[model samples]
Target: MLPAMGDNVVVSTMELEKLLSMKGGKGEASYVNNSQAQAMHAKSMLHLLKETLDRVEVEASREMPFVVVDLGCSCGINTINVVDVMIKHIMKRYEGLGLDPPEFSAFFSDLPSNDFNTLFQLLPPMPNYGVSMEECLAAKNHRSYFAAGVPGSFYRRLFPARSINVFHSAFSLHWLSQVPEAVTEKRSSAYNKGRVFIHGANEITAIAYKKQFQTDLAAFLRSRSVEMKRGGSMFLVCLGRTSLDPTDQGGAGLLFGTHFQDAWDDLVLQGLISSEKRDSFNIPVYAPSLQDFKEVVEGDGSFAIHKLEVFKGGSPLVVDQPDNASQVGKALANTCRSVSGVLVDAHIGEDLSHELFLRVEHRATCHGKDLLEQLQFYHIVASLSFVQS
Candidate 1:
């Protein structure tokens, strides 16, 4: 019943502004994106592209640098990882054509707050050896640009006019907190605590929030329209939610409350607040349903979808651990245990959050489910290209 794609539901630029700083609830914390995760996914994507190139008759040469860009370049590790993919693919393609590879510049981009120092750390060696991060020494390229992205929303202006080639964003986007007003009327009423489906609630507010999503999505595509060159490819990957009900949302990000839920639960056990307080609060998560993703992408006239894939239901990490399930549970809990203080309101009271680790371990041990064993996280991958006007 919400606005379909192309409605151009006008929204205030200011409201979108608030989402810029919105934080996900404790369960939404990130730990999967280390150097390894980055490399694994990046390489996989590279292989897929290489296979595609083998079958296609294309016209790209190293003489004129082809562009490769990563949005939400968080600290730039993943961007570097993605660029690694491009270089390898280019080399592979060159070998096939018997041509020397061209020099390409990577546009590492993200929110203004991104830690450039971290990104710069990876680049003292400008021309990373043709293969891997490890193979190359640090080198800097003045051509490598670090710039502030669109200020208020991803839907706004982000890059120069028609300057992008292949655009890639991973584990980013989908950070917008669902329209806050949509899920709550009561000051404390929030997502997954009977917000979206409340029959007697303020439908106007909810509609307003939903409209915001449409607006943001349009803006996002519009930005891509401006930033990306015609016929360029884009790969978007992010977490998604199945339930639209405001009262129920569960996933890797929401479950890992790994630290926050623990602290709050202890406070509840101590009679500090109702167990339901967690309801008013959700990790600032707004993972859309599969339909939501499709509608937005196809609805936008700017791009045509090339492919959409969903990966869910597995412990991609823990499954390979040599130990049995219980041992794996212990290991997962133990490794994440130290994250308690940094992730939660640990300063509010001494280790109020540390208690969460114990409960996590206990649940993982007794209930016989590691985080992934529970099988809650869902990933969505959608590829799209600009539609010719």
Candidate 2:
């Protein structure tokens, strides 16, 4: 078991799998309703996806289906949209070749706690494919594929060898497999005493986070390399930093600013929670720069990079309209809550989690305009091809 911080919380790999998931369901705070930013980011990569499909080599066997899997596909409309777009692009590519598109099997993969029920419910009804679940869903207007859910950590092997043809993931890879244990040790120099994230932490803490990211990303690539066919393609979009410095405020730092720490500090000051409790909590997320990512992929040597670039994402809230600061803050807060609320709730109780985000919302409202101006939600977009041995 991995120590999650204080002595009270010990997390096994399986427990971490269960805890690290987006807020489920279609409620206001759920990931489904609050994933507009993720949707926009996924749409930004459609051109790259098309390019990847054009370059991918698909077998012309009707007996073997073309398998496409979306890793870290949380329950949301964005997940559905991404799969639909990929299928359309693949079909178009095959039609241009004057060949019938092969049957497709779409796999939606995530942690065990993901809202698979809601995700399946949101999928469009499928035509009779003679599959066991007649109600099984597929991409909208494209019944050529059958859909199935694969629930597990993508850090581990989730598929048979040489099975997948195309893989896509967006805004997901930055998540570390688990928080660096050293940072949680009070006696260690890497202890992140005052911050819930490494964005503005000290050098030792930052190094610990970077090392963990490298390890996790390498493991992820290694697993995918085994599962992907020789000519298979992978298009990944994850949060990234523009600068090599982990503490730079221009990149992902803008999104996870001092507001969270401030809120926690306030709670501690108010005697709602102990300082030790606040110090023990840290978010297991790191946004690597392009160089950082390249180092890992090149080190793995299982996939050749076709394209890798950094791009910024747009805000989820309405920025064009007037008097939208409150709206913007609310949107940003909801977005953060959707992604990290589970972690916060697990550390503190749900009631304190609610109180904490209330403070976060207020802070975001006060600084919404500044965030809009300075925020650069950089993403490292990579198109890779499996390197044949």
Candidate 3:
């Protein structure tokens, strides 16, 4: 049964852990197929990643493996690609220093509901570092890093103190631990009636979202500070807004565009879902402004910031070709579905969830040109070193 989202009900952290996850498996609707945009975003930061790695001081020890972790590593080839790149670069850095590279141990982490089985299945038997199959097999024990899955929320501790040597998280931190309880309470000033997200919402609603993000991010940093080794490097990439105004959509306007809101309205209008239920459903996500992000990390004081900057990228949808509106709309719908399908399904059931996205696709098709114009993607990338004290 779907959890009740009554006017007085508060969405708990445990509830979110159960409900939030990408559409799993290898099917057309799976996140693995629809995450090209996320993959591209991560790829764009490779230079920064390499630079951060170069700054990372590797303490060689035969007794301890060189540990690295990718948090929020949803099921995809992208996760594997990232792990492969990090391993290869670290190995190269070791060879450049004329020292034997310690055996690598790459940990993939995410919520318990993430498609870990698929991620494991997708991993290559040996790390692909431009080596021949024969060579890879011969040096498997020596050259290839060990791979393991660690399932949990990044907002909590997942490893032993000072255990992880390096950490990377891409497009994940925007997810809040839970929807702010006040936003769901009808009596509260921050009640977010008729909205599924904070974008374009009133000031009170936006503030509620911002506070939740601050709390969740702080917890995330505190947990990582305990787990990361002294001088270890961490790289992060997450969606962000360009404007300081909490409600300003900027380029992310496309994500929470009128079309998305209209889809929910359609459901309510058709009596497919109760108005109360519609009101209660809110996506637990927040794209902080660059300043908002910087302030949180600075306040934490457990890590020294090396690089913090915002970059813009074109829409992940392939819209360069003629008659691209329909394609772009389909892509947008699929992307949204892949990311939020589980939540919608849990809230409205499978049949209505399918109906909801179909409406989203149709509406997105009609507004494709306008959406494309406003569809620029903005991300904040940061590199930090864990400070031992």
- Best by the TM-score measure: 3
Cα deviation of 26, candidate 2, in Å: 1.2
Instruction: Quote model 1's TM-score.
Output: 0.66
Q: Which rank order by TM-score, best down to worst?
A: 3, 2, 1
List the candidate 2 regions with Cα displacement exceeding 4 Å.
1-12, 129-142, 249-251, 316-322
State which candidate has the highest lDDT.
3
Off by over 4 Å in 3: 1-8, 127-143, 319-322
Residue 310 C-alpha lDDT in model 2: 89
lDDT of 3: 0.83
Per-residue error (Å), model 2, residue 19? 0.5
lDDT tens readout by residue for model 1, 1-389: 11111111122235334323212122323322222343455555554454432432224554555567777665535566566655556456666777654555577665554445556666535443354332332233422222223333355676787767677777666554233553433443333342212222344543444455556666688788887766677777765556664223345443444333554566668875454443343333445566667877777778777677665533323435534656545544643432222323312233444455555656555544445455455666677777767
Q: Write the per-residue lDDT of candidate 3 for residues 1-389, one digit (tens) a residue.
A: 45434433566899899778888898877899898878787787899999888878887665788889999999998988888788788888887888866777899999999999998888777646677533553563333677899999999999999889889999899889999998888888998888887878889998998899988989999999999988799999888878888887655556755666789899999988887888788888888888888889999999999999987756756444525778778877888889888888877778888898899899989877776666778888999998879
